[model samples]
Target chain A: MRALDVDYMLGLLPILLGYVPLTLFMAVVGMAFALVLAALMAVERVVRIPVLDIFVRLFISFFRGTPLLVQLFLFYFGLPQMLSFLTTINGVTATIMGLTLHFSAYMAESIRAAILGVDRAQWEASLAVGMTQAQMMRRIILPQAARVAAPTLVNYFIDMVKSTSLAFTLGVTELMGAAQKEAAGSFLYFEAFLVVATIYWIMVEALSFGQRRLETFLNKAHAR
Target chain B: MISVQNLNKSFGATPVLQDISLDIQPGERVVVIGPSGTGKSTLLRCLNFLDTPDSGKITIGDLSVDAAHASRADILGLRRRTGFVFQNYALFANKTARQNITEALVTVKGMSRADADARADTILRETGLEARADAYPASLSGGQQQRVGIGRAMALDAELLLFDEPTSALDPEWVGEVLDLMRKLAESRQTMLIVTHEMQFAREIADRILFMDDGRIAEEGPPADLLDTPRDPRTRAFLRRVG
Candidate 1:
C-alpha cells in the first residue's frame, strides 16, 4: 500500500474552498423552502380540515418513508420522463427541491407533535377568552409551539447541511462534488475525502452548539 | 341577564345534565354547589359554550349560545362577553403574568401593545400580582397563578365572569387570598357564577346559592336561607356532607 500524500492533500484545500459557498447556498436555500413548507404542513395537520388532512398525511408519509437520494433521482431523472416540461430542471434546482420536500416531511411531524404537546386546557382557555380558531393559533398556539419546536428544527437544519452532499450524486458541483473530482484527477482519494468530511463535521458541530443555546433560551421559562 | 332553558348534555349514553333550566339576573352572584361528578362543572362550562350541550338554549343578555343555531363567529362573540376562570388556573406556561393577561386584549380586541400593557398592569395590581407581573406561570405559586387567571379574565372586561372551583387547587393558607379577591369582585357587583366547595366562602359572598344533584337544581335561594334551611332533602344531605 502507498503512503498518503500530505502535500498534495494540503494543496487541494484551496481548490475545495471554492465550492464551500455553493454548498452553503444549497443548504440555506433548501432550509428556507423546507421551513415554509413545514410550517404550512404543521398548521394543516393541527387544523385537520376534512379532505386536506388526508392529502397532508399522504404527503408526509411518502416523503418521510423513502430515502432522500431516491427522491432526488425521482425528481431530477424520473419526473422529467413523465412530464417533459421538467426536463429543463437544473441539478441545483432539483437538489433544493428534493431536500425541501424530504426535510419538510420530517419537520412537519416534529412541529405537529410540539403543537399537540401543548395542554388541551389552553385551547379551552383560549376559546373561553373569545379568540377565534385562527386567532388562537396565530397568537397563542403557534408562538408556544415554535418555542418547543425550535431546537428540533435546528437539528433538522444540521441534517440538511449534511444531506446537501447528495447533490454530488446528482452532478451538482457542491463541496463533496469538488472533492471527488479533485481526488479522481490526482488519485489522492483518501486525502480529498478526509478534507470534505472535516468540513461537514465542523458545520454540524457549529450547528449543534447553536442548538444547545437555543434550547436553553426557549426553556428559560420552565427552568426554575 | 342569563337564562338557561331545558339544557341537556350527555357524554355518550350517560346523561350529565338533564332538563336543567335557570335564570340569573344582572349583578347577581350565584354559587353552584354539588357532590363530585354531579355536573356542576359541566353546567358552568356549558354556560360559556365550552362544553356544547346536546340540546338546550343558553341566552346571555340577548345572545343565544346553542351549538345548533349559533354560528362559530356568534359563539366566539358570546365567549368574549363571558370570562371564565378555571380550577387549575390554566395560565399559558410560556408567557409572563403580564403577557398572559394582555394576550387576548392585543390579539382578539386589536388593542395597541401599549394600551394592552397598561390595562394588564392595572389589572395585575388589582389582583395583587403587580410585583410578579414579569414572572412566568411556573415561577408563581398555585394561588398567584389563579390570581393571574382572574386578572386575565378581568382584563377582558366581560359582562359575566365564571369561576369553576377557583380555589380548589390552592393550599388551605393560600385559599384565603383567592377567596378574598372573589369577595372584592362580588362587592363591586360583578355578575359572577362560581362553582366551589368552600361553603364558608359561598355563604359569605354568594347572593344566591344553588344546590345541584344529578344535573338538576335541587334547591336555590338566598345563601342564608339555603345554607340554614334547605327545602330539599337532597340539598340538606349534600350541605351536611360538605360541611
Candidate 2:
C-alpha cells in the first residue's frame, strides 16, 4: 500500500500557486475578447441585415458545433500552416484566440436571446419617442439586455476559467500544465492533482460567490 | 394635423387594412373602437409608420410618410413627431421609471443629462409616481407602469400621441386610474388618436368616434351621435356587445 504524504502535497502548493496568475490572465483576457465579439454578433443577428446575417449564422454554427479541443488544434495547428503570419503566433495568444472564438459563439446566443426577450413594443416605444436605431440600441436595448445576459455571461466566464485547463495542450504551462509537469518529475501523480484540484475548486467557488452577489444586485435593481 | 389617403395593408394574403381614408385635424381627439380582428390598431400603427402600409399616403404636418414614397430617414422623422403608447406599457424592464422617461430625451433629443433628469422628475411627479420614480416596471402596479409609459411619450413633446388599448392590460380596479390620466391628458388639448374598449371614457372624452370592422371603417362620427345613435348596424351591435 502506498502511504499518503502530506509533505509532497505541501511541496506542490507553491508550484501550483505560481501558475495562478497565468490562469487568471488567460480567463480574463479571453472573456473580454469574447464579450465584445459576442455583442457584435448579437446585434447583427437581431437586425437581420442582408447577407451579413447569413455569414454570422454560419460563423456561430461552425464555432458552436465543434468541440473546443478540436477548435484549439485547428487555430493553433491548422491556421499556422494555412497562413504564414499566424505561424509566428505564440502559445498564449493561440490559446486566447481559441478561447475567445469558442466562448463568443455561446455568448452571442445568450446575448441574442436576451435582446429578443425584450418586448417587441419596446422597439416601437423607442421609435415613438424619436430615438434613432443606433441611439435606441446604445441607450435602451443594450442596457436591458445586459441585465438579462449578466448571469449567463458569468457562467460562461466560470466555464472559461475551468476551460483554461485545455491551454496546456497549446504549451502555455498554466496551472494544470504546471501540475502535470510537477507530477511527471516527482512521480507523485495523486499528490500533484489533488493540490491542483483544490486550487481550482477554491477559485471557482470565489467566482461563483461573486456572481451570486452581482445577480442579487441586478435583481434588486430590476425590482425597483 | 394628420391625413391618410387610400391606405392599404396586409399580412401575406390576409388583409388587415384596405383602402382606408381619414383625416385628423390639429388638436383633434379621435377614438377608434372595433372588434378584436378589425384594423383599428393597424390604422393607429400606420399613422407613425410603426407598421408600413402596403399602399397609401400618410401626411403629418409637412412630412409625407408613405412606405413607397418616404425614405427611412423621413419615416424616423415622422415617428419622432408622433408618440405611441402600447397596450403592454412596454417599459424597459431594466430601467427605473425615471430612466425610462429620460432615455429618449437624452439619446434623441440631445438634452443634457441634468435637464433630462429635471424634466423626467417633473413628469414622474405629475404622473403621481414621484415616490416610485426609482422603481422598475416589475415592482410597480400595472397602472403605474402605464402612467410611466404615458410620461415617456409625453416627454418627447410629440405633435400627436397614439394610444393602443392603454388600459386593456390593467386590472379592473386599476383601470380607472389610467383612464383618469388619459382624461387629464385629453383636457390638455393634446392631439390624440386612441384605440380603446372603455366606452364610457370614449363617450365622455372623444371629439370624434370611428368604429372599424373587418379592415374598414364601418362607421365614424362625433361620439355623442355615434354612441347614442350609430349610423351603421355593425357599429350599433359592437357598442351593444362591449357596453
lDDT tens readout by residue for model 1, A1-224: 88888888788877887887888888899999998898789989988999999999999999999999999999999999999999999999999999999999999999899889888888888899888888777777777788889988998898899889999898998899899888888878899999888888887898889888888888877876
Q: Which stretches in model 1 have alpha-carbon errors above 4 Å?
A: none
CA RMSD (A), model 1 = 1.7
Interface RMSD (Å) of candidate 2: 1.7
lDDT of 2 at A223: 54
Model 1 Cα lDDT, one tens digit per residue, B1-243 = 888899999999999999999888889999999889989999989877888888888888878777457777768877988999999998987789999999989988999999999999889888998899999998999889999999899889888999999998898888989998889989999999999999988999898999999978889999999999888999989888877
Kindly provide the TM-score of model 2 when superposed on the true structure, using C-alpha atoms.
0.93
Per-residue lDDT of candidate 2, residues B144-241 (tens digit): 99999999998888889999999988899889889888898899998999999999899998999999999998889998899999889998888889
Model 1, chain A: how large is the TM-score? 0.92
DockQ of 1: 0.77
lDDT of 2 at A140: 76
lDDT of 2 at A8: 92
What DockQ does predicted model 2 obtain? 0.64
